[model samples]
Target: MTTDQPVRAAVAAPGGPRPPQDGPDRGRGGPDRPERDGPPAEGPPAEEARRGFLAKAFGVTALLSAAGSVLGLLRDLLLARYFGANQGTDAFLVAWTVPETAAPLLIEDAMAFLLVPAFSLALVLREERPTGPDPVRQLVRATLPWLMLVLAACSVIAVVGAPHLVRLLAPGLADPQLAVTCTRITAFTILPFGVAGYLTSALRAHHRYTAPAAIYVAYNLGILALLLTCHAVWGVRSAALGVAFGSLLMAGVLVVPFVRGLRATRRPRRPCGPAGDSLVLIPLAILPVAAFTLTRQAQVFVERYLGSGLPPGAISHLNYAAKVSQLAMTAAILIVLVTFPVVARALAAGDLTAARDRVEKDLGQATALVLMGTAFLMACAPSVVALLFERGAFGPHDTAVTAAVIRVYGLGLPAQALIGVMVRPYFSIRPVVRRADDPAATGRTTLLDWYPVGAMALGLLVTVAVGVAATPRLGALGLAAGNAAGITAAAALLMRGLLLRGIALRLPRVLGGQARLLAAGVGAAALGVPAAAVTADPLLSTLLGGTAVILAFAALGTALGAPEVRGPVLGLLRALCPPSPPAAEGKLPHGR
Candidate 1:
């Protein structure tokens, strides 16, 4: 598959792998044919076509993810109104930490980053020898059993040790017992989430994105339903139970699609290859990725742990603020998710240039979106937080603290987006050797592999040190600042590492684009701040001010000639209202 082809479902040919039909047209002519064109035709419009496909796919995924985020927002609203940032909510948030920490390892972007490339490589290799045993199937079969075993052991440990873990995560909680009970209920989600991760990887490999994208929506919906129906009876513990049930529901939602994807790709197979032979390479690939995830998650753990030592509501404040700040980041991540598998596929096929191009584009676009979001959120943090979470048990003071924390977190949105895009290339880098027994198989052996882990470690250390040092004085604001510093450092290190490995990022161009976006963002804030100030009602202020800000950003971005802004807008317009057909021959009398 070349860059100019629409990513399509693979079909087997009798002789070999069939050409993907969705690619650019190669005019039919043997070498014997006379030349007819004035200039030699360039490569088929594959890049443009692929971009169109991505744009449409991203638009759909964004809509679904936005819907899920809304549900998540509602969940937070209920938690705030019903419980506020009190001991009960704090206890629940502590229990929630289990999933928060485990998600990156299982159902979040880290899992996708690690597995997509592996699955892509397996699929490509299998396609090369269509009649051979399917490597993807073999790989999954070999890996799943071990995954289940590890998951089961981890779940048992977590269940048995929930009390100890709760004490460790939030030592200052007023109601440690409630947290322990909630932790026990939430611990079981680890196994289901692990299963969901595998299913997500499988679906994405087959280019089946709808089901994977919808999994979060389903998960959130399940939680919302349970909380509504059972919260009265079960209290805050209901939310914990909801999480476990939701994880199962999340995985359940993907099973049929995953199975269908497998059936579509299935071929008559001989006995599978030596089962454990393929298993060695998986751990080799996963370990560094896992290390990176652990370090990232550790930052959150550190923040919450330190926040616990603050006022009673401090943990809940941090959680609420972080969730609101994350809304934009989550949307940016969903947009980038569309590109991960494509970049991985390119790398698996040994097209380094294509992979690099995809990474650069994804980084720029995600950054632009995130920065725009940062500008809006930071400028209107108070109004936004107040509108979203100021009613019921969530009082004005809670809104003020949460808003401040959100503003601080907004400072890091661009760095977060950059890390999200940059890390994928490292994960997608094809290994030179697969043998675990090889002396050079250690992760640190190559700069390509070692730098990401090193960057992550450095970031984690900075986060813990800064968070621990500052939280006592500045509370959640200090923690948010530490997170920003840490991620910024990580993003810089990752960019530097990529450059050292000769992957030129054309940093000047990227920075220039970012500068334009920043200018647009500032211009938007200039207009929005007053719009927000003029209104006394928080909801009215947010709606009116947000609309003005968005309009200003779009206008300034277009005037600045930002492709990241213009391209998507144009693509969406085209998608919604396609070009009109040419007037019929000699049929324009009415117009005349």
Candidate 2:
């Protein structure tokens, strides 16, 4: 079957061979009804459509992020001016870390990882046969009770354990009074994350991915406003309150639309069985999911531990530097966030081939997108930090520390991109076709929705452990190493799970391409580094050096067949040029 084929047979040929299958027409009125091909049904055209969707997704997210970045820059500038990366910022950083970690744990993992993919799968399953009661509605209806329960439980746990968590994370918070105040504030607001998480998940499931994704920009803006408006009035406590208010505001926005959707879909066209009657079964899986997200939070806990040991402003310096890494190419991450559920649904329907294709396309695009961003950030790290935060309590020393961390974290950009892609298999919907060694099951395939939550949980633990060990030894640089190792290990294990389950990796082919991309990266870095070393002005030097490096990287990678390296470069060039009349022969017909 070609990539254009929409309906794939779950059944396998003898000895795990693929059975001959035709296109969508062949599967009409069958158990697996094919979805409408948005445009042409051919592979190349289909790939092009997928690219278009990704571009639009990227564009929307980028615009929103750019706005948020500008606002954050201003906010940080004000904080730097007033607070100047001192004890106040340190207190704020330690306080915020608890909730900030929630971005990945509660928002990214709880909502995006589990809920969105599960929701998307339901839609895909029902889309193949829309006449029946919508599986989408059934899933949503069943999901709510569990979401609420989890929210309440998380709130109680956070409130009860806040002080202990503070002590564990920031041992330096020896002042009983200060520690108690920060912990109380942080715990009071933790419930908002639980509420916001479910609401965001609901929106994602409804295909309103953009709004909730963008809601974060507002969340950040609120924080920015709080810092600027209240810092002078209420001091650090006000800053903590700002975060609390921001999270609550985010929760409010997330819930309003979600509730509307809930009311609209109150009754399903087709009722589900008792298993789907409550969210209990679905949320049973959240333990693994929560574990997966918590491991990410553990890294922040580690940072706070090591951070408290540093000088007064050290935690704030590390925090700012981490944000540079986190927010850089954030729009691209959002694009991935939007696309993941769509891909998950395809994977869950026993469509391994389709899943593989979607993974490659999105992974390839994301790799290119992030690589360009890495190049830009690496070249201009000092300048970027200086321009954004230097005016505030941010001084030369703080800038120096932050820039150093950013440069080190920059080294792990590609690895993080790869990790993002590798994690997808954990949520894959591959069919357990007749195992290669099993013969009686020929032409039979069982859809296996393996939510490798266990692997994810293990991976998170590995990541946190590695990060903690590395950070203490290497300083900020060690943190980056830990991140790479943990994520790489997690990704490796996820892929291995597929292999262990009998899916072929075609290692030689994959490695061959990766080698080419790596070579290009190295070659670019080789020249860029030397140029940067000799240049007088760091920012200007970076601009000149980075351009040379990217040109070299793109040329070499393209020549050597790195699809990840070539596709987006061409897309970017196309985006730059104005639309022109169709050419006759080689020359432009007009307006060239």
Top-lDDT candidate index: 1
- The global Cα lDDT (0 to 1) of model 1 is 0.76
- CA RMSD per model (angstroms): 7.6, 8.7
TM-score of 1: 0.87
> Runs in model 2 with CA error above 4 Å?
1-50, 128-133, 174-176, 256-283, 329-331, 428-474, 501-505, 530-542, 570-592
What ranges in model 1 sit over 4 Å off?
Answer: 1-42, 270-282, 431-448, 568-592
lDDT of 2 by residue, 177-237 (tens): 5555665676656667767776776565554555565666677777777777777777777
Give per-model TM-scores: 0.87, 0.78
Q: 513 in model 2: Cα distance from truth in Å? A: 2.8
lDDT of each: 0.76, 0.60
Best by TM-score: 1
Whole-model alpha-carbon lDDT for candidate 2:
0.60
TM-score of 2: 0.78
* Ten residues in sequence with the least summed lDDT for candidate 2: 8-17
